[model samples]
Target: MNYNGLFTHKLDALKEQGSYRHFLEVNKSAQHFPNFYYTNEEGVKRSAINWCSNDYLCMSTHEDVIAKLSFVSHRSGTGSSGTRNISGTTIYHRELENTLSNWHKKEAALLFNGAYQANTTTLKTLGKHIDNLVFISDECNHASIIEGIKSSGNEKRIFKHNDLIHLEEILQGINIDQPKIIVFESVYSMMGTIAPIKKIVALAKKYNALTYVDEVHAVGLYGNSGAGIVEQEHLEQEIDIVNGTLSKAIGVFGGYIAASNILIDFIRSFGTGFIFTTSLPPAVCAAATKSIQLIQRDDSLRKKFHENVLLLRKRMEENALPFSVNDSHITRIHIGNATQCKQLADDLLKIQGVYLQPINFPTVPIGNECLRIIVTSRHEPKHINHLVFSLKKLIYGDDTHNREIFSALSVADVENEA
Candidate 1:
């Protein structure tokens, strides 16, 4: 078999369709971020401003967080050196889990290696253990959720994104006594849209279904204590399960699911992903615990984060850029075509030192390609202004030149609340 030829053919197809992913090697500078050093495809180290970082509050570089991480790593060894059941459960892990459960106002919490694993393993365990379990998920759910539900070999129903009416119709078809879970996200990162969580919760109650909300993008960035959207919207007691990531907004590394003690125990005991995989290192748990404490005590970081978000949206609006608004800390500058989206990103990185990755299929549907920007608290007005100015020059061309890198965008193709 010409195995290499087959692999190359498939990879070439990805490049042809512009769906191939090329990772940029970057080193973020604590003193000057948004501005970072990145090694390009040509192996040249270049400076660039990042507008797509998931470090919402920049807590990863916090002095106290770093101190705790270093302290733990020095006291303990570097690695856990075992799975959770085999000498991997340290005091740091227990402390972090306890802190998380209290923060989410849940009876218990179970730690996972990553948020993706948390979702996939938790859902898989629930589906496999519960007889006749059904998952009614949002169509726009992350790939991890889709993979888990599909892997369970259970019946899966997908409703249109945030469409309560369609969701209810699907629920009505299922038996009232049937065990079902409504899986969705608190914030759609790519489009900067907030879900109708309250309405979805109501539907779940009416249908006697469990609710699972992925708070990966919302935790440490919402609520008074940085609990997440449930706490922010006063739905903490209503949500059955909340899966969150320490890596994103928390600015650490790990994932957890907050739930009732019974459900938590069940997953921890039976989940293959949790039972067999190695646990998080002591330093990571310590750093995450410290970061969570910081977020709870400080609101200035979150305020600055929202301020930067508003500044960015305002700048884009002033320049008549085609972008969508969901009153969140994300800006989705719509370019429509995948090829054009990649071109815009490349031009911005190469010519203006601005960096943002393009969102394309199958991450998003065709014709919905765009550049998703996530501004952190560290980003200032100058960075926002630079980004807008660079985007305008590349997308709209300067007065001296007639360079048109993108086609004319139609009102229908663009989704703007400007």
Candidate 2:
């Protein structure tokens, strides 16, 4: 067969397996919330209530943040034009780092373009310092960490998801004197489950290992002043390095690692991700600074966001929708097969005007297909009601719970059908 024919055959296989993805064009007015009206192929405008975005706090289009962005853009132009080690280190970059260090209660902070680079650089760089660097990572850690660990050429031990006993057992098996790093996330992005940070920190102490926490999802959304899981659990002192991002909660784009001054200095001098990449533009840094200030000064937004989460979760539970048990703003509704998950998302969008992108492998495992719904403070009660109604219609063909143990359906079951 011809090479093109073979490639086409592979594409057809993906479609048959329910893994082929297509992008939908949106051409309409934008809004503050993820939900917006978009023009379809026929130039027809339709309203879509988006549930797939990572904008947890709905600060992306805030007036204050936008104003700062505008002001900084006027002053600093469009881009940084050079790497941070060269000319990209602007006053805005310095200010953002200082603000972040203060927010997380760390001695120093270093900024990266995003969390992916932050994790990759930190993990890979740390691997070089220790004689024998051992990584104990959670099985469900983000792909960024996975790639970082892989590149480091270090011996990695993956613990079962949220299983303290397994994690402890692995630590116990490792040589106590070897330099070890326990890498994990405060709040997992896909699963929406929070790590047992306190317990993990305790284990780190017992094993004399460094605790590197990726608070990408939890930062600017948890704690009294949006410090993240370490602050929320009062384990800030215990955690050695706290990695976070400004894109999600702070309503901007960038990533940072907060730690002791010595550690920050070491990474700053050696980490290629930071040294080679151009620093974030002055406008983004300004917007992030303003956003952090807002999150710190105002507690009402956090409260409202939490309440919205509770309301949405309650509605889902009342409707007998299949979901995970982890407590956070992320509410994942499990739909067994990848095809069914995509179909459900598509049907809800077209029929009910509710929009959620279907999460399939390898973002998730093969069988654990889900529709991850993120609720924000800006979402009204009616939005939750519509989501519940649409989900009920799609999942059960009616609002009836005749299926047994919706949570028990394994990834294998879905994959087998596919």
Name the candidate that leads on TM-score: 1
Residue-level lDDT of model 2, residues 1-418, one tens digit each, is 4999999998998898798887766432226365688776677888788776667777787789989999999988979988987889999999999999999999999999998999999999998776699999999999999998988899999999889999999999999998899999999878888899989988999998999999999988899898887899888788999999999888899999999999999999999888988889989998999999999999888888899999988887787775776677777766758877787777788888888888887788987778889887788899999999887776667442323324465534433432
Task: Tell me each candidate's RMSD, in Å, in order.
Answer: 1.9, 3.6
Candidate 1 minimal-lDDT segment of 10 residues: 399-408
Candidate-wise lDDT, in order:
0.89, 0.85
lDDT for 255 in candidate 1 is 95
Write one digit per residue (lDDT tens) for candidate 1, span 1-418: 9999999999999899888888877898977877899887788899999888899999988999999999999999788988999999999999999999999999999999999999999999999999999999999899989988998899999999888889999999999999999999998887777888999999999999999999989998888887878899999899999999999988999999999999999999999999998899999999999999999998999989988888888888888776775756778877667777787788889989999999898998887888898899998888889999998888777641314534466333466422
For each candidate in turn, the TM-score is: 0.96, 0.92
Give me the runs in candidate 2 sitting further than 4 Å from their true place: 1-13, 26-34, 41-43, 398-418
